[model samples]
Target chain A: MSLRLAVLGAGAVGGSVLDLAGDYGHDVVAFADSSSSAVDPAGLDPSAVHDRKEREGVVGDADPEAVFDADYDVLVEATPTTLGDAEPGFSHVERALGDDRHVVLANKGPVAERYADLRALEAESAGTVQFEAAVGGAIPVLSTISDLGAPHVTAARGVLNGTANFILSRMAAEGLDYEHVLAEAQDLGVAEADPTFDVDGIDAALKFVILANVLSDGKTEYALDDAEVEGIRNVPGTALDLAAEDGRTVRLIGEATADGVRVAPRLVPQGSALSVTGTQNIVQLETKHAGQLNISGRGAGGPETATAVLSDVSRLE
Target chain B: MSLRLAVLGAGAVGGSVLDLAGDYGHDVVAFADSSSSAVDPAGLDPSAVHDRKEREGVVGDADPEAVFDADYDVLVEATPTTLGDAEPGFSHVERALGDDRHVVLANKGPVAERYADLRALEAESAGTVQFEAAVGGAIPVLSTISDLGAPHVTAARGVLNGTANFILSRMAAEGLDYEHVLAEAQDLGVAEADPTFDVDGIDAALKFVILANVLSDGKTEYALDDAEVEGIRNVPGTALDLAAEDGRTVRLIGEATADGVRVAPRLVPQGSALSVTGTQNIVQLETKHAGQLNISGRGAGGPETATAVLSDVSRLE
Candidate 1:
């Protein structure tokens, strides 16, 4: 069951996947960053690739297009996420699917924006598509939904963004304003230089859009525009203080159902499972017969998201 | 993918399975109680069977042993769990496997007490074994482990028994003694007349033993005797008040790993995910690569447990 993988994107997630693929009984035959490519049909050494990427700012000497020529079974797409047409990542997925090679995605762009197009491509190909890493990092949310069968799951809602959740939970805990906490988060590397995506609810919204698409089961296609998103920036310190006084707290929660997708900062009971602390994520599924199912975990990080990607790779086998 | 189901045990879980099997596009071809049995080559009406059982205290006039004579694709075992030897349930499972029929279990006895024997029988039979309902009732704990591959999961722990959790949380919430809460829970039908199985941690211990067996994957076999069990009856109201003042709460928690299984009342942070109140249950898995995964939901009920059984039946298909 060892699969030959051609991984795109040498960022944290892709690099970690390359590092851990062998541990899961898989081989990395081809790898690519934005500007360079590394191809070895005999299987590339992870450490060697890491060393070259660090010292030379490039994975290897080959052209980036060479990845398409490499003989591989599964294509691992961990590239940076982009909105709109979800280009580059979408095209990469299309090429892989067109070749009848299985595609495992960590990029949320294509899945959140172009689900119908992606699924249509998959429908025509021999290879299947899986994107467990695109949602709640290492939490098996999609697989659980698949196991329960989408029709039985009535609704899904959760804290999907770790950065936003971390900021909000920290604000509630310390009674700090948005500016102060965002600055501290930036210093701690928890928030990116431009934290618009994480703080403004787009990241969480995209994950919920993907969930809505999955739950809808091709009956209705959902995109980012369909969601009504509200971020953590608007949640004031006074609001959190008042909530805490009432034994409640504010959390950036995203909800998806047959109706639509919505992400907003909402109040929850202080001791509730949804009120998970810094950098944690939780998804609550309302099942038709099984009652509520809550799954929470570290929804981000290199090794964590990589574990999800590798899990998807194993499923392909 | 319509499966002919032969349901045993006319209790809550089995009766619910017979009632809802049709909703999942399956047919109950045969059903039995301890004293009576019903067989139909086509399908038995759920309401008619329920009415007969309600009126006459039996499912049908046929002998209980006649269930073995019916043609079934899968055998649903929801009988009362027995600790030592796990008898009657074990024999029913053995008969079904001997007949080369798939066995989906809601009985924890055969799984927790006789895992090795059950797996050994499965090794020789063409039919596979699945017991999702045996662990966390409705929550998808075992399937998550299966999807992640048990080797990737390092350890598992959780609040499993709902009756104990309800009593403990009520005591902690209302500052009431265990006796008072136990009486209230019994009156509310949350705890059984003899709540020893749940309150004494035996029930949670059985679940963790089954988890230990699954995580160990045949390297070792675990039974109820192997677990270090401690009940919640000794958790005083004063202790709960002290812990709550310190922003912590006591919960009847169960932990399972390669080392062993332990079920005892443990203190957790008041706002922590593990401090789920009321009858809710949660299992946290510590994965090797992925950080930590928490899955919580209804751990027991007629329809909830039946949903798990039907989910297993779907997997078999």
Candidate 2:
């Protein structure tokens, strides 16, 4: 079955979703960004949309607000994350859910910060919310928990942040200090200019909160402040060297248990499943009967996140 | 929604299914073994069934053939795998699918040896077939592909066999030969008495065939003979030691590409995703857009496989 999609935020994720929509049997009916938007009652051609966006500054001539009322089956929110109170992204998701349209989120803020509100909206709305891309990029972590059902999941732990992990991995491998590795990561475009969101563990913590909510199916609501957070910024070079002596590696790990969410730099055995390397993510789910299940992959990338969004769209009945 | 199930096979897999059915919100109304069968339309108590099976040496007093005529929404096939023609398991699956009942397979023979027949049956039948347990037990590998839509999958590679992996991992860690480790694994109840299916690469090849068929959505029929198989029986410890000098590890890998399927021992980088140890299994999917996705878990165990079966049952909408 083909689904009509109104995509907000024409960034890498949203743009790739438009690019790959036809491949997954979905049609893009509308496209929106902060400044410009486009719409068609029928489906918009992905290639044509791409050309238009490239040739012009926007997707089309329509107003940004036009996407809110566009006739579509699913609304994809891929805007930049707004941590506290989750602004424009929050409003975008709320408006979409209010219209009884299924929402597929690539934005992490609204999910991690405003999960309860989204759940409330879903309770009265005809459409459901899917955010597989919100946590682990292409890793299908949330859907795995949902597929197995909530009650069966006992604990979820993983390397949820890519940039932080990249820095830590480089530090351990090259015996470099935190600042030197951070500079290298920044230069390589892996870490952001500020890098506080990632290096301070807030990004991983946010993803952990979202995972916790997903595992509980919204029964357990955890916010950013609820987690016991620690970053890799304080991890010294000597620590990695000392860990290596014991045949271990330092990974910035995010864990969500019944107790709550925790994100910190943890010493992991060198060859274990949790000892994943740079830019790679792993989610280890402890189940009541299924035993420990670990899923790892590219945690973040535009096309990779777009693939996750497309997977969610295809899964919608 | 609760599904009525008639399970065939009274081994660890089938028994664990009955034991864990109540926890997963399903009812086990009927169960069958080679010699005896049981029925409880109102839903049999898992503990009671366990006690009966222990005391009577059978599930119940009914004839084994009675299972074919029993009424149920879904059928769980956990019969032992038979190579080549895939006898009793194939026949059991055909009967269930013919009767318009959803089939959840824990058996490998039917899936590996009879993909084309099963696909035809699914097309003609009202009910669907789910076999997450057939590939990587409790890892949700098959369903992940199915959910992502098979067309997007470019290639799939993994550590599919647990017994072979366990023996190889033991050999590598202790610097012992295959025979010594195999004997230790046998004593530890990790390897089977004969271990032919595992050590000979047939088991891994069968799973690779099934996975290849799944990736093609059964459009491409691949059997055991289709794969270029090589057993780990001849892998010398000297080779592992040589690889370890360069920070590499030896693993028995199964790969399925558009070209064909292959099972053999390969050298993997020590800290790579494919370098999973012991009885763990890892499936790395290379997608057109999702990048490289990896899922790893316990590939064998009565309860782990049973949990996969239970997950399949709950997912049969």
Candidate 3:
């Protein structure tokens, strides 16, 4: 059965989902952005919707609220991350779940900031929520842990923040300082103009929080504040050089264990799985039975994150 | 709901499964070895069963045929790997499937040697087959692909043979020849006394065949003969030195694509995901949408393989 999808946030990631929906045998029936909205109870032509968003800069003139009553089996939330209130994303998720629509989230805010509320919403609603794209982009880290079951997962650790990793890796390789590499990353569009979230460890901490919630199978709750966060902004080039000399590399590692969650720069052996560089993400699940299983891939990109959203839709089926 | 399992092999893998069954909320209702079998419809005590196997050298005095009529929900096939005929393992799986019981395989024979037959058996039976343990011991490689839906996976590549990898890694790190490392691996119990299947790359080929079958969602059939096999038997220490000079490492990689499946020594960069050392296995899936996903972990071990079997049980749920 093909899913009828209503997508919120017609940005790159959400638009990419619309672009690939047809290939995955799904129809995007509704779309909404912060400024504009569109809806088709029957089924909207994905190409037509995509073209409209690309050329005209708006999906349709329909009121954004129309998505609440719009005909869709699943709601794809790809809104930007907002920590405190989880904003329009959280509200969008609430309305979708309240109306009995399955939700596939690429937005990190609703998951990382308000996990407890999200779980409560899911518990009372008929529709389920899936957020594979929220954490490690295209990597199915959440599903892997969930599939293995809560009892089996002992811990989850990885190089979650791509921008930080990119900077650290370059600094290590070229003997350059942090500011130089950060500037280079920004120039290359690898790091955002305001790289606080990426560099300050908030991004990795948020991902670790989400992973912890998944590992607990929603029996427990965690928030950004709960984690002890430490980004790579303070990691020295000398440390990376010394580590490299010892056949190791410094990586911005995020970990979630039974005790707590933390994100910090750590010295990983050069050939270790966690020593992945660039815009790559790796999640290593320490299982009681299975040993350590490491999954690595492109952590973020329009098409890549969209692939995860599409995978979530398939999972809903 | 607890799964009632009948294990067909009282060796380490099977025994480990029995040992850890209770923790996963599973009950080993029956167990059989080459010489003896045991059955308790109510459920066998995991600790007792483990002790009996370790101390008494046999699980029970009943004939092996007793397992055929055993009351169980799933059959755990942990029998030894017999490539050609796939013998007792194949027959055990066949009988279990015929009886409409779910089968979780740790044995590579039934999967690698008789994939087509296995698929046919599954199609005709109400019970499904899961074999995460067959390829990568504790790694959830099969389930990861299956969960993403086979349609998304375009190709799969991996360092599959643990013994070969152990030997190769030791050879590379210690600047020892294959012969020297092989002996050390055997002494460390990492490789078998007569390690023809592993050294000859047949073990890796078998895993590649199984992964290919999975990538195609069992639509395509593959066997041991289908792969162009090459092992790490002839890898010299000099070659490792040469590769290292260029920042590359030689790994016994098994690859399955639309073109063909092959197991051979490939030059993977030192920091590459496939450059896993020792007995670690890494499977990289080339997806049409999700980009490349790399999963690495222990490919084979008694307890680790048992974890995969237990995970398969969870997947059945």
Candidate 4:
């Protein structure tokens, strides 16, 4: 049961998959960057990760020829999260899944936008594509939903965007404004220069889509295009003050619950998990069996998410 | 594949277990409540739960024994957390396990203090004594640990006691002292009149013991007694204010990273799941394969815990 994995677009997440594959000592087929350097189809050593890093852009440079010719059993999609088009990793995931590669996605694009295609592709291939890393870095949420009893999950909700939560926490605690927090987040590389996805609820919305599909087993209907998106930009420093009026707090919860599905900044009073996690993204599910379950942690950062990618790779073993 | 179930000391949790069982149409045999109503080996009917309120020492007056004797497949131990040698659940859990009946425990005391005896009994019977509902209400953490791919989990950590978390949440928000919060929690029945196990970290320590034994297959060397059991009984408002100064909140995290095991109220800068769960209990686990995972909700309500019992019953089906 040794799997030969070919990782596409070796960026932060892609490189993570590669590093994990190397660490796990799985058989890695080749390195195919779209730029700079490429490995011939003979298969490259996963051990050469350090050397590959030394040659900047040599991994995520995206060389399809090498990727197509790899002796790999699965393709790990770890390209950057493009806004809508699934740009860098979307097409790569489609090709890998189409080419009979069992897919494990740490990338946010493919399953976020083109989930239907991936579902159909998995059905057609009779293989599987696991994307638990999409929402909460290393949370076993997706698998928990799928493998648990045939549950009729009503809604999947949580604080999906880690960067947004940090901003809110700062706003609540230090009384800092959104701009100040966003500037720091971007400078720290925690938020992108164009942080529309993280801020405007798009990222959380994407995760909700993944959860809905998994919880409902692709039969539950959801409206992706009509997601009620709201950013933390409008959150007030006085929101925490208002929360203090009732021994409560404010949290930006992106959820799909019984009232259909929604992503909103909620006024959660005291006596909830929402107020404890200062900057960690906590994802929760409300179902028929379990009323409400909270899952929390650092939803971003390299070590945590990199460890998550490694966990996915470990699943192959 | 029928199981002989005997429910011992039918309280809220025990009665709720049988209530959920009746809904699923499970067969129960010999509900052993020391109450005056137990001459025949009749299965308890969970529907007429209100009838227990009708008479003194009449436990199963709720639903007329739904199933007659000799129909159960297991025994359920849902007694209160007894302390020291006066332990009540100890006898029942030990008896059921010895009887080769699959045991489901919601009690933490008998397992925590007398872990060796319970484990020996279970080993002798070669029967599983499940306790998913023991640790966190409806979280499925124990089951998740049991099902994980890694044979040796590097660590298992969580907010195991809902009452303690609830008290901490009050202290964090209302700036209320621990004594005040403790009294309130006891009034709400969240904590016992003598709330030592929860506030002193004994309850979480007990759950940790069970997890270490079962998930690690009883091979790991870890002493919960040595854990830095810092309770939330003496949290200073100054600490909360200082945490607020740094844009942070405080939470009692039972963490077992490479840094070793500890249970203390740590300062968490906002945007974390711990921060968000104001009074509810949220649990997270870091496993070898799953990385960091989380689960949150009402960790100690009758309905929520009852739901956890239902989850177990569903699995039995």
Candidate 5:
């Protein structure tokens, strides 16, 4: 079951996947960052690649396009997610599928922005696509849905964005305003410097969009633009304080159904399953016959997301 | 993809499975209670069977043993759980597997008490044994473990019993003594006439024992006797009040690892994910590299448990 992987993108998720693939009994035959490529038919040493990427500006001396020419069983798309065209990530998946190679994606752009196109490509290719890492970091949301059968699952909703959740939970616990907490989060490396995608609910919306597409099973296609999204920026500390007075708490909840997707700050009862705190994430699935199922875990991290990617790689035939 | 099912036992789970099987694109060819059975080569009408059972106090005029003679692709073992020998249910499973036919169990005794034997029979048969309904009712606990690959999961801990959880949550919320809550639960039909199995932690222990067996992947066999069990019979309202004063509450928590299984009423943070309220169940899996994954849902019920049974039926090749 060992697979030869050509991993694209050298960020934390990609680097961690390359570093941990060997532990999961997989070999990295080709790897590339935006500007550089490292290719080898035989497995490349992860540490050697890491050391080269650290000391030198590039991962290797080979051209970036050389990864397409290398022998690989799956294309690991871990590149930074783009909004509209989905860039080289989408193209990388197309090329891999065209070559009849499996694709495992950590990038959200190709999935969230262009789900129908991605699936159409998958329909024509012998290779399948799996992107467990694109949704809930380490949580097995997609697989659970698949196991339960998508048609049986009525809707999916919960805390998806860890940065927003962390900020909201911290603000509620400390009684601080949005501005103060965002500053503290940036200083603590919990939030990015710009922080628009993570804070403005786009990140969560994209995930729900992907979920909607999956749940609809190609009956309806969903994109980020179809979602009704609202972030935590306007959720003041006073609103949280009022909620706490009534024995409730606020969480950045994202919901996805066949109809549409919505991400907003909502009040949940204190100590409820949906009230996961800090950097934790949760997904509550409303099933047709079974009652609600809640799955929560570390939603975002280099190693956490990498485990999901590795799990996907292991699931491939 | 339509499967021919022979459902055993006339209890809630078995009845629900018979009632809902046709909706899932499956046909029930044979159904049995202790005294009688209804056998039809062409599918039996669920309402007709129910009507006959209601008026005549039997499912049909046929002998209960006639179920084996009828054609069936899967045997649905929903018989009441019995400890030690785990008979009737175990024998039913053995006969189905012996015939190289698939078996889906809603009964806990065979899985919780005789896991090694069941797995051994499965190994020799062309059919597979799936018992998702045996633990956590409708919650997809076992399937999640299977997807994560049992070796990658370090431990599983949570609230697996609903009746016990309902009593505990009621005691904590109403500030009532254990006796008062037990009486109220009995009046509400939440607790059975004999609540010893649930209130004594044996029910949750059985589930954790099954979880331990699955997580170990046959490396270790766990039985009810192997678990160190403590129930909520001794947890007074005063203890819950004292814990609540300090932002904590008590829950009947169960833990299972490669080492052993233990179930006890433990204190958890008031707003933590583990502190799910009334009749709800939650399982937190400590994974090797993916961090902790929590799955919570309704642990028991007729339609709820039936969904898990039907889900298992759908998974059969």
Candidate 6:
């Protein structure tokens, strides 16, 4: 029952999945990242994995291409958010699938951007591409879709980005302006320094795109560029105040429909579970068959991502 | 890859799974119900499963003892709610697991009443039990617990019951009373003739017991008797009018902690997503590590249950 796992982009999620795979007694064969584009010969040091993070060109001095060279059955992709536009990242996914390697993506960029083509890539290779960690970190969003068959998923919606949620929660709680809270989030290592993807709702947009494509039937996929996204930059501290005045809470909501999708800030009432859900967490998804299905918890981070990746590994059977 | 599956009950979910399994070419050896206490040699016709519904004791008329005696590896328990304290219905689960059969329960009552003893019986036989459809119907709540790992789940909370929710939704929208709507639900065949389990919160209370046992961390055993139960009987129709006056929605909420559990009607803000989640649906599960995770979809009926059972068959690998 040992799966030969090859990790692409030896950053936070990739490293954590490798650790879990080792714990679960899976064989780790290859390791690569942007820092070291060539494959490692001596096998990955499980201990050294936690020391890296994905930046622009590298992660912990390892190149992304190196992780793909190992003779492995499955590839775990944890590249940075290229918004599915990065040539190298998309090529990496295609190459893994072309190699007949089972693909598991943690990055939202590829599937969100070119889901039709990547889905075709899966069929062309006759390989499975499981990416439960992509949409909502590890909230079981993707798996839930697989579980329910998504027939009743009339509308898919949620707080898909933890960084934006953190910003919104800070704005709601501390009565601070959006910029001030986002800066604090970056300094606290919650939001990225180049927070365009998270702040402008692009991150959540990418998630909705995939959710629309993967989790729904007869549902139109949304273009990330076309989504009506409003970042947390201008949300005044008084937003939460107004919500509080009306016994409501403010949350950045992402939604999908038959026609298109929308991701923006909305006012939710106080004492509502979604209103109470704060900081790096998300809640909301109403389905036709199963009623109002809620998936909340850590919207981002390594441990949840690791569980998601392991779930992909389990799907190899 | 086809797995031999024997359905223990020919009720709504069991019959649906059997039809799909037969269509998909899974080797279904026999059928079991109250009448067929023993497994019969000749397989039951999947096509004719529903023809006996009008017969007196539909389950018992199928040769219950004969069904259990048949050679089968996977046993699907899909009867209506029956406690371990009851006869005929619940004992089938214990006997099957005790005999080393891999059991998947869409039936809620057996697990609700005697989870620990059942788990112990499964342990003795070294059997795997899958019950994703038990707690939240098609919602994957159980799998969510498994995906997040046993460590990260602190409390199991959200909207678990659906029949009551439909009543609440009607009350909120049309300004109707609980009893009147209950009568309508029964006429619509959504609620049973005697709606104590569905309307009185006993159903959700039972589901809470099952979830708590799974997440209780070596507590090994728990009971529904320990739970503080509240049905929708106390919720006045005027409450919805008042909530409407204040822009709120009344929802039947179920919450379970390590110490105890409660299922009652609550007044959540009307515009809130929880309030908007209407009719035969379910809501979130806030995991300890993952935060407030939402999963909405159809909570009852044949399609969702059929999908769940078929998905279980797919997971036999």
Question: Which candidate number would show the highest DockQ if scored against the true structure?
Answer: 1
Error of 6 at A46 (Å): 3.3
lDDT (10s digit) by residue, model 6, range A227-277: 777766677888778887887777878877665778888887664556644
Q: Model-by-model lDDT, in order?
A: 0.94, 0.89, 0.88, 0.64, 0.92, 0.71
Candidate 6: tens digits of C-alpha lDDT, residues B135-254: 777667777776665555677776777888888888777888888888998999878898888888888888887887878754756667877889898899998898889877788887
Better of 1 and 2 by DockQ: 1
- Evaluate residue B281 in candidate 3 and report its C-alpha lDDT on the 0 to 100 scale: 87
Q: Write the per-residue lDDT of candidate 4 for residues B1-317, one digit (tens) a residue.
A: 33445566566676665555554445555554544323234554554433653555565443323312334566666667765642667776665566566777777766655666677788888566667777777776765554444352567766777777778777777887788888988998888988888888777766666555555554443445645678777777678777877878777777654444578777875655556444466566665543566666666655567666655655554
Off by over 4 Å in 3: none
**Alpha-carbon RMSD of each model:** 1.2, 1.6, 1.6, 6.0, 1.6, 6.5
Q: Which candidate is the best by TM-score?
A: 1
Docking class of 5: medium
Worst 10-residue lDDT window for candidate 2 chain A reads: A211-220
lDDT of 2 by residue, B1-317 (tens): 88888999989899999888888878889998889989988888888778988998888889987887777999999989898889988898888888999999999998899889888888999988888898988888888887788999988998999998998888878899999999998999888899999999999999889989988876689999899999999999888889889999889999999988999999998878888888999999999988888898889888999988988898886
Query: How would you encode candidate 5's per-residue C-alpha lDDT over A58-98 as one tens digit per residue?
Result: 99989888999999999999999899889978999999999
Colliding residue pairs in candidate 5 = none
Give each prediction's DockQ, rounded to 2 decimals: 0.83, 0.77, 0.74, 0.27, 0.73, 0.32
Candidate 3 residue pairs that clash = B137-B299
Top candidate when judged by lDDT against the true structure? 1
For TM-score, candidate 3 versus 4, the one ahead is 3
TM-score of each: 0.98, 0.97, 0.97, 0.73, 0.97, 0.71
Off by over 4 Å in 1: none
* Model 5 stretches astray by more than 4 angstroms: none
Query: Ten residues in a row with the worst lDDT in model 6 chain A?
Result: A51-60
Task: Please state the error at residue B316 of candidate 5 in Å.
Answer: 1.7
Please provide, for model 3 over A1-317, each residue's C-alpha lDDT reduced to its tens digit, 9 standing for 90 to 100.
79999989888898898888888889888888887888887777767877787898888888877877877899999989999789989999999999989999999999999998999999999999999999999888988877778778999999888899899889988999999999999999999899999999999999999998888777778989899998888888899889988999999889999877999888898867888878889999998876888999999998889988988999898
